[model samples]
Target: MSGDEKGPVLQFATFQSSVDEGFWHGLSSLKLNKLKTDETPISIMGFYTPCSNPHVSSHLTLLAESLPTEPSDGLPTATTHGNRNKCSVPGTLYNTNTLEGYQSLDKKGLLQAEGKKIWEDIRSGKAEEDSSVLLRFLVVSFADLKKFHFYYSIAFPAVVLDPPATLVDLRPASEWFTLEEAESVSACCNEWRMSSLTADVPFFLVCISSNSNATIRPLKDFKACQHEDQKILFAFYDPYHGPNNPGWPLRNYLAFISARWNINKVQFLCYRENRGFADLGLSLVGEALIQPSQAWQDEEHVPKVIGWELNKERKVSRRVDLSTSMDPTRMVVSAA
Candidate 1:
């Protein structure tokens, strides 16, 4: 297909900052360690698309079917408390697709057959035979947009999926003050840090309704939904904010990363709204503004990191110097 018919292409830029000078010193000290380990830094890439149309279900199904299957080794072994075996039970196959009339009948039959196969595997003990199952698959789902609400819960022997332990309602605040919000969000993030330090398992938190009008504190203050080592952070926001509120969601997100986490980079995938300009204005703003520019080739490129020097008191009080460096991409957000 030609470039025009290839579908929407989104771009992203990620920034990294260190609050503790020791962190930077330690990183520089580790330069030789990295070379010895031969571990190359890596970045993540994702695609975002509108989830409201008829094609959403088909897209989700296609992605799920294409995912790599788990190996035959026994599931990850766990000795933790609270009947850990409960998590070992394979998840139920759910049908999140909304269909009408005759379409519903045909789809339902196909889904039932798929579900049956998965259920049989679980019952026969064929699914739980892998030791690294838990860490093998990622669950990709759109928790907000109505167009694509399907969930792809991978079946792995080593990985165990945990439900949300805490719910944070951000609707109470009327507005957010950048720095102040950061502090509050930092407190919430402490919870995740503590969990990560204690339990060796991963966790996750899903923001139910993030929008411009919705009160969002800094990311540091919000508690971490999962452990620090997990590979994913699924964030959702209502796409109603205009250019003036462009930085709100991102700022709060940075706060989350600031508390006990070093964000090396970020990547974003955006799904353009299919509706005409009248429905959702065609302006380039917020997450939509990250598209590749003509000046920079159409292919996505990594962002440059601008460094700075800190004050004697260890505070970011003044800019001492600036330098540019290339690093692996960190976070990836798909916008649709």
Candidate 2:
């Protein structure tokens, strides 16, 4: 896809100021410390049902199912994490199709040689019981919130899926975990592309109404989840709860990450009558925004965003109306 179709993509490291700079440094420093990461063994991975995002679910499923038989493992190099003779999890998150925990400006060239066997086991469907599981780390989509700030800054603990946790109830009233203290990051939005308009468009905050994972309690006790010994953060959002204002649910999402580290939450425009979920930002990581151009206005690619409130049954709705947000003349996204 052309850059136009890609929209105003922000390299996670490409921050607007020193704030962005310090963020990357903290992440990088943590990765290199053997004392902090070696035993940590952070095997990050996540999955969403077809309903939350058909495109992404399809993309992830296709990759998982399309795995060619395990290829030969590349030999490990002399390089080690810091001066200690140990390796961290997967080397880098740079250029990973999914966002979160990645460094786009990485010039030293980090390679993921460790997870090849685990990756194969996962794809082959006979994942052996291992300490790190299948993925070396997590996989959150850019379409979720359109930026990496939140996954790190605001949604720190929510970033990874702890499959072993005693799943939290996903219902609105039942789905909030509070942090005693959490650092707040600036909400940043990237410029998006419009198929019909020549001027720059912006990213829309499309909230999630439902998802397949809703049934599981990945968040455990609602206070935190654990994959082994590590304490992880999680928040299950209600489709129709109050998200317009950053209340407990929204603040709780930030708190989950904040309890671990300072994370940056993002700001976005609600395209509809602003009736979408504002109760929590948990939906941001699961949202799908597919557009012919970066503008997210193409109808063909414009996904159906279905949601429901606690007081009512679930309903399907268009997250945005191209006719309202972009040039109506040729606003519809054609599949052709």
Candidate 3:
């Protein structure tokens, strides 16, 4: 439609996280056997897919398979190769020993710390090398083994744009592209998604020629498109299907674009899908205008972060009670 029709300031749909019971079981195994009393951040993974249903939103999910098969005690940890059904995003877990430790954690400071890593990657060109760096997240938890209750909080740290980005134009991909352009873009996107090498990659560039030919390239090849006369669209596998809003990943993606490319205006695609293939009806394409600030030039200063999964309008931590289902003694008694 139009920028005015969608709203001026761009709003993003936040991720709703879901944890499988097996995830807690795996954590318990690691804590008791391999990582006793260790407070160091452990590498983890989270999975999500493009929103396929109009009424439902996709979740950032944690399963037992998300954790490493072995501890990295001087040995390399083996990571899972995610498939199209669930693309893996890297994350970290900070398992505190006590409730006091978890409660005393500097939430704001932690978020900024993680956010700074992302900002550094953007400026250092590491995010371009491996675009998955933009989706990194952190989790702080107190796994009460005795009570089988886990108190935790998750943050998908996003670098704040001081002036915030303005939407110049926003609408469905079907409306934004002509018939030939849509077909070419969809074919290119399908090829990107089906490849084992690029299927898990979340960010990429789509170059469209005046003749409506489209090609998908890795984020690392962004520079290659500099001299091309084609229209370049920054695309990501959007996990949200909101009619007007993009997903959480766009926040850092914008920061990366503004910092790395110094491009104030951007064309982007929220590449959503239906049944594992590209769906132009559910996807969105838009142009955003951002202000590249002087603060970004300073290496030491990191922008403010704004991602904290909320609960009932409060930025409070959450607790999950798994005693009934996970406690062996309780389970045995219930069976009797």
Candidate 4:
């Protein structure tokens, strides 16, 4: 099908960030922008515990908050490097409160619970029932996304797996499209398996949580670079325990990209760094700025790590320009 047929699929899915609604704003409220060029008619199952009062929708309202990001150096604080203290993620596209909400849910069993339901839905064909509750995915931007490729980042991979029979359907805070499921729905993932995705639209399913386990494994006989698209579809597993801080994790990310082939473009939105950008193979990097009107949790300056091939370097670039960097593209990657 063509744009004339399916209409123009959204160029970006901007999950909006707002504080007035507080933490549990529901998936619909997270949306920030919509392209008005083309028109298409659009329209959920039970993946969340229902709450009539938005004020007390879930544990987010009770446990999470839009904490501020702090300097890793120069600034001093008694706060430790964990979720128990104040924290926030960097980036204009982020919702600080929503991230806190997600972090809170990770502490609970919401992710695992929602993962099971999502798997059940895919197996039973009830995906539309809980569509509204499932978070909307858009091409807001991400680190290291390349032209003609679909780059994926699994910040928290637990929710994508079907939980053990003992933990089936626990009514988690939200449901999400899993890694395997994402492959199932994407034409770009033909290496993963056959596709069941609706043919015309692009997909970007994102989730962030404070959950980090050393035992985490993202391998399923599928690798990020193995996309049928033959462009560059890289997937990263960021299990950083401390929020905002990027030293250990960012160093690891730089090292990880250094080992990969042709991955030169990188962008990051972390809050903390133990060393200067020079430590991460970045040079002459400038702060990527964002508008306060469009700011989620603005950082003083966003830096680009520059140089991935010459020095086997992985330099971060400016923010991802959704216009060309990301698309469901012609690359046909698939799922099981």
Root-mean-square deviation of each candidate, in angstroms?
24.0, 22.8, 2.6, 25.9
Better of 1 and 2 by TM-score: 1
Task: Provide the overall lDDT of each model, using Cα atoms, as 2-decimal numbers.
Answer: 0.23, 0.22, 0.86, 0.21
Sort all candidates by TM-score, best to worst.
3, 1, 2, 4
- Model 4 spans with C-alpha error above 4 angstroms: 1-112, 122-229, 232-336
| TM-score against native, each model | 0.19, 0.19, 0.94, 0.17
Clashing pairs in 3: none
lDDT tens digits, residues 141-190, model 3? Answer: 99999999999998899998977888888899999999999999999999
Q: Who wins the TM-score comparison?
A: 3
lDDT, candidate 2, 1-336, per-residue tens: 233433332211000000133223333333334223232223322211111221111111111211112232222222321211111222212222234333342221111233233324333333222212222332221111222222221111111111111111122211232221110100111111112221111111222212311211222232322223332222222111222221112222222232222223322222111121121232222211222223222222211111111112322111212222223334354422
Q: Per model, how many backbone clashes are there?
A: 36, 19, 0, 27
Model 4 TM-score is 0.17
106-144: candidate 4 lDDT, tens digit per residue: 212322333333334333333223222122211111212
The better-scoring model by TM-score among 2 and 3 is: 3
- TM-score between candidate 2 and the true structure: 0.19
Error of 1 at 102 (Å): 44
lDDT of 1 by residue, 117-195 (tens): 4333333333334211112211211111122122222211110011101111121111221344333333333333234
**Ten-residue segment with the worst summed lDDT in candidate 1?**
156-165
